[model samples]
Target: MTSETYPVDATNRVKRRHDRGRYDHATVHALLDAAALCHVAYVVDGQPYCTPTLFWREGTHLYWHGSSASRMLRNQSDGQPACLTVTHLDSLVLARCGFNHSADYRSVMAFGRARLVEEPGETARALTMMVDRFFPGRTATLRPSTGQEIKATAVVVMEIERASAKIRAKGVADDEEDYALPIYAERLPMRTLIGAPEPCPRLAGDVARPENLAAYREGRALEDALADAYRTAYP
Candidate 1:
């Protein structure tokens, strides 16, 4: 989408290479849905710290969990400004020249305030959402979260006031003169590799694969079928 179609507010500015930027809900949500981890940055006593954490998205909001005693969560619960970034590396473009080397990636940056969700039921729901975000139908099959487990966890909800997405996906761009140079150059791809599924040692030798584990059996991309499996098995 063009920048005019996806307007940016005071908080989210489309800086540098504005042509490659997007602010629409569809662009941002797509990147968020495909990602599992996010790097959260915040200021503490004039210093900045970026902590990596597991995250999930619900419409225009993002939820992340931390220990109840974590300093980041404690400060965020006090109503501090936070910046969350989610990124997916698609591939690496190895050019003939070092300066031309680059990576194909999609990323989203959100700016907003974070607050704690202390309610018992809401906290449990957030945890379940987190689980479903990664492995669909896992929460239902696993044992329910205990009360002590809920109490020990801290959930932070961030309203996406301003956000933008950046994407770079293409083959190597070589200068007209460089094309005649004697060098091998191309895009060497990288992807998530899944190995053969190994069963637990305690399972019976004759036990067959469960329906929920069929995705792994076919060697499919985790992001492609996770949500659908969750909806089918849990609904």
Candidate 2:
């Protein structure tokens, strides 16, 4: 089904106007694809626990891995609802007053039932997808995941049926009366910065920077462009 056809249920706790919310698959997947980290919230004994984890997408399913003994995974596998959220902070907007300070960001929150992937091949593929999602080409350079490694890890799959994307971006809004206030108002943009690439101390002689590092040279502003470059260069 197309993203427009994906069902959207009211899952946002804040409920800021419904118009800003979106249910399309494109909106949901785009937010997931832009970042590698997600905050997973689940309930255990009536209390909520939110843990940050690395995640990846395949078709409409979201998969994350954890230690086989992880409490979060165990709880979800035992039958509980979970919420996964992915967010990218693009900038910070500062207005004349503290109340006007805000962040420009894109975030997606998904509610789904989590299941444990018990099949050996499926588990291995999930792990491989996770690695490649983060490092792109590193999967080929690293040793293959062994049976022991798979056994030591746990993979959870969440089928997203109800989800929404909320975004607040750029500029400042001030009350008409407050606009004349003496306080200065302006947006202090924020961005990701990539430091010079560091190499392993054990590596011999002057090793050149890897092609993967090229996209991160300037951080977030160039992230989209870098991603295109990475896909072109690596794929």
Candidate RMSDs in Å, in order, are 3.4, 2.9
In model 2, what are the clashing residue pairs, if there are any?
3-25
**Residue 212 CA displacement from its true place in model 1, Å:** 2.7
TM-score, candidate 1, is 0.85
- Global Cα lDDT for candidate 1: 0.78
How do the residues 1-235 of candidate 1 rate in per-residue lDDT, one tens digit apiece?
2343335876677677777788888788777776667999999999999999988777677899989889889889866899999877788887778888888888999988999987878887888877776666678877787878877889999988789999888779777788889988888666554568888889857977667666654466655564454355345
Candidate 2 per-residue lDDT, tens place, 1-235, comes to 4456357544643388555676778777767776667899998988889999988776678889999899888888844799999777877787888887888778898888898988878977777767766566667876687878778899999888678888877579777788898888777666555566567888768866668655665444444643444354335
What overall lDDT goes with each candidate model? 0.78, 0.75
In candidate 1, position 109 carries an lDDT of: 94
lDDT of 2: 0.75
Model 2: lDDT of residue 159: 85
